[model samples]
Target: MEFYLKENGVRTQLEYGELDISGNEDYGYRPFQLMIASIAGCSASVFRKILTKKKIEIEDLHITAEAERDAEHANKITKISLHFIVKGENLDKGKLEKSLELAKKNCTMVQSVKGSIEVVETLELINLSN
Candidate 1:
């Protein structure tokens, strides 16, 4: 795989496996998708780590994310939201919120989008697995 980026540019071009993929694609996930994924992935990892550290037993975890794109020219993402649903035992809502806060604070990707994007998050607890 070869990746190229123009000097002082935000966009990058990537080539891999007989495919030409740019920062944004026509059919596959766009650049914004990758950005959101990084945020969600970072937060999810922090959440899991915090839960494990607190000795909270987790049976499953999932995150659903959505973003609103600007309709005008130079289309870009304006807002993003993520719903974090965790199935675990003896979960504490306060702790979960705190963990999320710390996740956003520590996540380089989340901080990278600061002021450029708006992010909202929700936490949900699910019944323990059978």
Candidate 2:
């Protein structure tokens, strides 16, 4: 939530703990990296919660996230894609879709960037018992 200037071109991000996120990539994580991570992490967990509450049993869940940045000034992220791979017995595509919709709607990070960023979701439902 806060940042400290360590030295020229060097800084640290502060929140629950201190992390080096300097302007120089050699030092630590970049701001954009953290942003996408926050988005992916928040939505991933939110989806888990929603599915659990809906009594959907799953063996595993994996997510891959990516972002696209604008070419103009600011070069901010314009779109984000979240791909979910769910492994389970008798996974309901309809229920899974509904859960993802709810997660996208409710995730705090997603909601925060709702107006500025376009978020996309995809899923691969794998039935191990098949």
List the pairs of residues colliding in candidate 1: none
Over 26-92, each residue of candidate 2 has an lDDT whose tens digit, in order, gives 8777888888899999999999999989999999999999999997958899999999999999898
Worst 10 residues of 1 by lDDT: 12-21
| Candidate 2, superposed: residue stretches over 4 Å from native | 8-16
When superposed on Cα atoms, how far off is each prediction in RMSD?
4.9, 1.9
- Clashes per model (N, Cα, C within 3 A): 0, 0
The residue-level lDDT of candidate 2 at 3 comes to 58
Question: What would the per-residue lDDT of candidate 1 be over residues 34-109, giving only the tens digit for each residue?
Answer: 7789889988887778777877777888999999889894778888898999787777778878887877787777
Best by lDDT: 2
TM-score of each: 0.76, 0.89
lDDT of 1 at 32: 71
* Reference-based lDDT, each prediction: 0.76, 0.89
Model 1 Cα RMSD, 1 decimal: 4.9
